[model samples]
Structure formats: C-alpha cells, structure tokens
Target: MSSTDAPRRATIADVAREAGVATSTASVVFSGKAKVAAATRDRVLSAAAELGYAGPDPRAASLRRGRSGIVAVVLEGHLRTAFLDPVTTAMMDGLTDGLADLSSGILLMRDEAGDDAAALANAPVDAVVLIGCSGRARASLEIVRARGLPVVVIEGEAGEGIPRITLDNAAASATIARHVRDLGHRDVALVTLPLDSDRERAPVTDARLAAATVDVTVERLTGTREVFPDAPAVSASGSFIDEGVRVGRLLLADPAARPTAVLAQSDLLAVGVIRAAEELGLRVPDDLSVAGFDGIAVDGISDVTLTTSVQPAVEKGRAAGEQVARMLRGERGVTQHFTCRFRAGTTTAPPANR
Candidate 1:
C-alpha cells in the first residue's frame, strides 16, 4: 500500500484488452466519431466499468484528434436577450439533442462583430452555428471563414458555399397578412422585429427599410407588404414584450388614427398589442383585430389565442446541428429548408366596422 506500490491508471488500451477488442474500437465507443455494433459497445462499456476506466479525457482526446471537440453557437446581440425568446430556447434545446452523440460541447458567443471580433477569432471550436444572426454579426463571418471552420446558420442568410437552416419567413408572414386581409380588415398596421443590428425602436420609414440588413426582418416585411401595400408599419427595438408595448402604444395612441387590425411579427409583440388595445378600452377582434407570428404559447397573457404561423424552431436547430456534424466528418456544405404551419386562433376575427 506504500506510494511506490501504487497501481498504474487504466487507459483505452487496457479497456480494449479487457473487452477483447482493438484500441480503435474502444476509442470510437467513447469518442462517438464512428459507429460500432450495439453488443460490442455494451461489452466495451462493461470492461471500462470493471477496470475503473472513466473513458477518455476530452483534453487528451482533442490533442490526439487535432479537434477542439467544441461547437460555438453565435447569437446576435446580448446572450440574455437571445435566451428570452421562446423560439430561440426551443431551437437550442433541439440543437443540444442533435449534437448530443457527437461528444461535443456547446459554447455560446455574442457576435458583436467589431467589439468581440478578436475573441470570436480566437475561440477554440471545431464548428460554428449562427442563430438568427443580424447584419452586424454577418460581418464576423469573414473571421470565421478565415479560420477555416465549418459554419451553419439557422434562420439567417450566409451567402454561397455555406450551409443554412432557413425558414420560409416571407411565405409565412404572407400567410398571416393574407388572413388579416381576408377578414375584411382594410385598416391594418404591421409591427416588425428589428430591421437592423442597431435595434432601433422607431416607426418604419422608407429610409430604415432601404437600409435594413437583417434578412428575416426584410423577408417578413416583404411578405406583409404583399398583402397590405399601403398599411402603416412600426419597427420594434427588439423581440420582447416591452418593445411590443412601445410599438403598440405608438400605433394605437390616437383613436382617430388607430387601425382596425395589427399584425405583429412575434407572439410576444402580439400580446403587447392586445395589452395596448385593452388599455385604450378596445376589445380584441370586436373593436381591434390582432395577429401574431410564431406559434408559441401565449397563455396567461390574455384569454385570446394567438392566430399565427408556427415554424419548427427545434427542427431548424436540429438541421443545423446535423449539417455541422456532417462537415466535421469531412462532408461538403449542405442546406436545409423548413416550412411553417398557419393556425387560426381566437385573436383574429372580422373587424366590427366591417
């Protein structure tokens, strides 16, 4: 029991010997880089447990494999804000599930191109996933490309030669707009997500639309415009309830100028619009019709169910993760397109005046 008599620590080779398999087989069992038979995997695990082999240390494995074994998830703006959106949260959950078997870790980085460029440039990650990135964040892509890292973007455009997990933003928004128009809502207004990385909370103007750099914002706006060509629209600073409230107040303040209906780009904003309507003694649908995108649960905000187009947020994340996995395995770039389902809820109805 003396220090000199201490036993040597077990390694993958020892585990492989105990399992009657090659070291490569044992390594793949732990690394998850390749597929092995279930029975063989079970035997390997049993041997590791018997020998007190706690699998491979990630650091040592990364050194041996020349990979970081980490994936960086780049989000636009503050990390806190990204987590607040239910859609983003759902997507992250799915991404986690999709990347689970890769034996990879997730590192969240805020893509403030100018300020964090150096940090992102130096981050130790085998792959990068851009989630709902804006124009400012898109500028950081050059740095990522310079590093020769594999890239996947969810709900954002990344130009050619890059894999993108995209939604039919324009088509979905158009569906919502058409529904509102079909309800005989002639006087309608549009509330939008931030049109640029500046996150300006102001009325939508020709200058801002012309200067828009966010693809999702632009696509959704284009969809709405297709149905309500002359409708007045306001852009929210962010995709939050308070931002929606600010937009709602600005649009519904004056009864003489109030629209009969409002189409909000997000469910949270729709809830805010309803709040503004109630504050002004206007009943939803009966006095003011409201519609929202993103089929997230809006219960407890009001009794009214939100009429919206529900995109597969989790599936989008999974698709991005799958693409990243493929790239890590030396596959070429791939792209995936997802569609949304439109559900009519209690929030949208024929305007009383109509």
Candidate 2:
C-alpha cells in the first residue's frame, strides 16, 4: 500500500470473526449488561485486544433514541460572568448527577444568543434547560419549543403545561426581612439582583419593578417589601462581590441617609457590602448591618457570618434535570418547589441606637 493509503479501522465484526463467535455475542461481551460464558467473554476480549478494538463507539448508540445525548443549559448572563456565583456551580453539580442515567453532556449557552445563534441553532442538542425562564430566556425557550425539544425551566415561568423547578424566593426573602425588622432595623435598604435583561445597576424604581422580567429578583424584592413596606432598594448588575460593593457604597455613602442595615440578594453581594462598609470605616452590626441570600461560603468578609437564607440550590438543579429526563421519556413532568431556611448570624444586630 502507498504511504498515504491507510488500513480501515477494525470493527466488532473483525473481532467476532477472530473470536469465532457471532457478532451479537461479541456485542454482549462489550456491553457487559448481559451474562455470557466466561470463556466466551474472555475469547471475545482477547480477540478485541488482538484487533486493537476499543469496544463500541457510544456516539452511534446515543443517536438510536433520536437524542444527541447533549442537554443545553441556557443561563441569564454571559457564561463567564454567570459561573462566578457558587450557586450556579453547585446547581450544575446536581444537574450532572441527575442526568447521569442519560450519560449526557452539558452545553452551556448564554441567553444573549440572538446576536450569534449559529451555535444554538446548529448544535445537535436533545433537550434544553433554561436556568431562568424570563426575558431573553423566554425567547430561547420559544426557539427550542418550535424545534419540538423537551425543555425544563428553573426559577422562571415558561407558561402553562410546563414543568418548573421553583424556589420560595418571596417567602424566604420575607422571612429574612422580618428577621432584620425584628432586630430593630427600621432604616434598611435592599441590594437586589438585576431587575431586567439589561441588568443595569441603578436605584430600584417603581417602573423598574413593574417591568422586571427576572422572576427570582422580583420575588425576593416583593418578599422584603412585605416586612419593610418602604425600604429603599438598589439593583446590582449581577450577583458578584464587586456589584455588591458598588451598591453598598451607593446605599451607605451618606451617614445622614445611610440605612442602618442592608439586605443583599446573595452571599457574594453581602460580602461585598461588608467589604464596602469596612472601606467606609463602618463596623458591621455596629454601624451598619449586612445580610445576604444563598447558603454558599464566600471567600471575603473574614470571620463575619452572614445572616441569610440558605436555599437548596443543588436540589433545584437536580429536579430540573430529572424533569427534563422525564419529558424525554414521554412522561409528564412534575413541577417541584423548594424553600430557603433562614440562618441568623453575627452579621446582623439590633440598630445601635435601639
């Protein structure tokens, strides 16, 4: 043969011929899901070794059910910016575990896929999971729905007859807000996640709340207002420490108008607020109290335990994944709800003058 001419890759047929066994028998040995004689299995294995065969390629098998074996996860911000939150990573772990039966891989797609949808449109994904089913996510959901793909929404609404994995954002936020109120914090302000798809950092205005698309942010804000009816709120661009610091400074810049306590929507945001308080020469719980949501460990704010709500983030992701799997199996998916537990910590205290 010429140097450019190469031999065809060995196949299970070649190995079966070498082992003097039927192709079906050889396949069973490779699948290992059925019983076969030890001698026969050993013969097949030895033949496979001699032929340099590495079992069957899963790529062809994965398509047998008309599934690409890839679950596309659509998230609200840029993939790089969104993964900075520990909650996303934790949820991803649970999602991976829940989809293990499918042996599927995850495809992380950003909500802003309109500008460049070549990847989203052409990618051979079996199902789509929208992290939040609002605004841009809704658009993506519509695109996939048109393609007749199974979808699961986490923490956002996708309309009627769709399985949703929701969280008690409103109730949990209300509970923590009541905790702050019980601590004699009358002058309190809220640091919120983004209100809309724009994710602009600004003061939480009435119009903005009315037009909010992100359900989690809206629910948490509504819950907090249940306790502090008139508490001022500011929106953060994202759930990062830097956004928290910026919002914290904006809320606590003037001692004359500074809120006695600040309620952040996330732990990283809370830590950022605390760091800002330190930057402004204010001691936590003494001059200013800060609390956050999510039960994840934050790196900064040394020794300061956050007063916050711990939600089952990972479980939420798992539930979404399981629901998607159910839908893929032609079964009706069920909606699941999760609640956050309030954890009182040293970061919050009664108003100093109280």
Candidate 3:
C-alpha cells in the first residue's frame, strides 16, 4: 500500500509495528542472516501472517544493485514445448548453479517472437543466453549486442568474438553412427531435430538440407552421414518423444521396407521409435535395432539401458553461466567446448540377418 486508505496491502513496516519491533528487526527475521530469540521470531512471523506481509520486496535489493539481476534464457520454441526436453532442463539447472554466486534469477523467453526481436529488446535482464542459433536467435544476439549487454550461447554459432558453449555434435554423432555401422546396420534410418526454424516435420530432402539453420541438427546429421552416407533421414518438428513416435510410425509402417536400425537424434525420439516397434510386434535389437543420443534416462525405457552418447549437460549450462559471469565482471568471455562419451547398452546388436 502506497498511502493510508480504507484497505491496503500490508508491508514489513506494518508487520514490525504489529509485532512491537523495529522495521530492521522484522526484516532480519525474514532474512534469516542473524539469529533472534525463538519467541521474537515467532512473534514477527505471526504478525507478518496476520498483516499478509510475506517479506520485503526483493526488487528493492536489485534496485540498490543497479541491475535487473536477471538472466534471460531464450529457447528455440514455445516455452511449454521447450521445457519438455530434459536436455534443456538439465542445461538450465547447470546454468542456475553457474549463476548461484550472483543470486540471479532466470527469465525464460522464446527465441522466435511474433515481432522482430521485440522480446529480447524489452527483457529487463542483465545478460542473455541463447540456446540455439535459429535465425531468430541470431537476430536476438544482434539485438542484445546493440544494447551492449553480455551474451553467451549454447550449442550454436557464437562467432564474431562472442562466447559460446559448444558440443561436439558432429564428432559424437559420427561415433554413435559408427557403433551402429560396425554392428552391421547397413540399412539404417535417421531421426533428426528440426532442420530449420519452421520446425517442419518431413522427409529430409536436398532443399530442406540446404535451408537448414540449426547447427546442432546439421552437425549431428553430418557426422552420421560420414558413416551411413545413404541413410534415409526423417526430420521431426522438434526433439520430443511424440514427434519421434510420429516419424517412427511413418518409417516403420512397411515392415518389408523399414530400415534394420533407427538412429534417433535424441533419446526421447529413440524411445518413441522403440514404442512404435513394440506396437508393430517387433522385438528390439531382434527385429529392429534402435539407438539414441543425449544419454537421458526415459522413465518408460528403464528396463533397457539406452545406447547413446552422454554429453555433460549440467556442465554445459554451468560453463555458459560462468562465461556470463565473466562478461558481467568486465572480463573477456572464453568459448568452451564439450564432448560426449559413447555408452553401449542392450539396445543394439548385429542385424538379425547378419
């Protein structure tokens, strides 16, 4: 409440008066920095509850800091759709840990906005982290740069002297593809993330391949092709289990024509392919071999350990945060590279006919 009125929201001052203590004392009770007598603490809390005073306004501290104390994380798609990916969630967790020293809050935003970089322009944040380099992400990077704020990108092009957290997507994908190839999976199919910002689900063709803007998708695909040059590729709209299931059905509908193995870009997609195989009464690694990336444990596929490449997801986020912290301190931000480790599980085997 700004002034005396008929009814007003309670403030910490009001709670202090009700508790018969000084405003600073009531504030310290909420801060929990210093210890107070049990009786005094309870009295202050009870008074706060009675007056509907939760705590001091946190914005006041940010105001004193002279910065928003917020870090904006731009995702490639809708916030709801983006959060569903465990990879993104893990990266965010790492990012939070990295920013822990700063006590900064995260501001999740969409990379693709209806207007041209309007969201990035209007975001009240001290720094920005772009997850992927869609066309929109590139634009957002420019916007943040023009505003003279620090920027860090994960798994995308952070060229032009910007710091980036990179994954060896191509090298890792090649390793996994070689694992499949060495297992005699001559006839194989590939499931990929979106080729472009449109997130269109379709059979990857020369036109789609040429128009690809997502470096991660392209890098992973490139690596696989080094092993399976003629492997048929299907691009999902996004990295999701259901999207995998959808394309899995299309790829496996004709048993006679289906590839002996499916190399999905993500574990969730691989799990979806496994589900599609089960629905068709096909035995995994017996009738159809399925492999995935990202090394995440999908709840439904616990019985079968996923054959994938485990990337350091948390470390990626933490590294990004650390770079952001460096830039915030007026220091040069360094680009960091991460690699993936291949893990073989019960999911892969030599082709049945091999």
TM-score for each of the candidates: 0.87, 0.95, 0.85
Candidate 2: global Cα-lDDT?
0.89
Q: Which lDDT tens digits does candidate 1 get at residues 113-194?
A: 5558888899889999988657867867778888999999888778789889989999999999999889898999999998
For each candidate, the alpha-carbon lDDT, in order, equals 0.88, 0.89, 0.90
RMSD of each: 4.3, 1.8, 4.1
For model 3, residues 1-354, the per-residue Cα lDDT tens digits are 557656766888899999999998998999999998999999999999988888877677787877898999988878888879999999999999999888889988887756636877977899999998777788888889999889999999867888999999999999999998999889999999899888888999988899899999999999999999999999999888888889999999997799999999999999999998898998998988899999886888758888999999999999999999888888999999999999998889999999
Which scores higher on TM-score, 1 or 2? 2
Stretches > 4 Å off in candidate 3: 1-58
How displaced is residue 217 in candidate 1, in Å? Answer: 0.7
The segments of candidate 1 whose C-alpha lies over 4 angstroms from its true place after superposition are 1-52
Cα shift from native, residue 292, model 1 (Å): 0.7
**TM-score for candidate 1:** 0.87
Better candidate by lDDT, 2 or 3: 3
Instruction: Give the per-residue lDDT digits (tens) of candidate 2, residues 175-245.
Output: 99999999889999999999998989999989999999999999999899999989999899999998888
Scored against the true structure, residue 161 in model 2 reaches a CA lDDT of: 81
Q: What's the residue-level lDDT of 326 in candidate 2?
A: 88
Q: Highest TM-score: give the candidate number.
A: 2
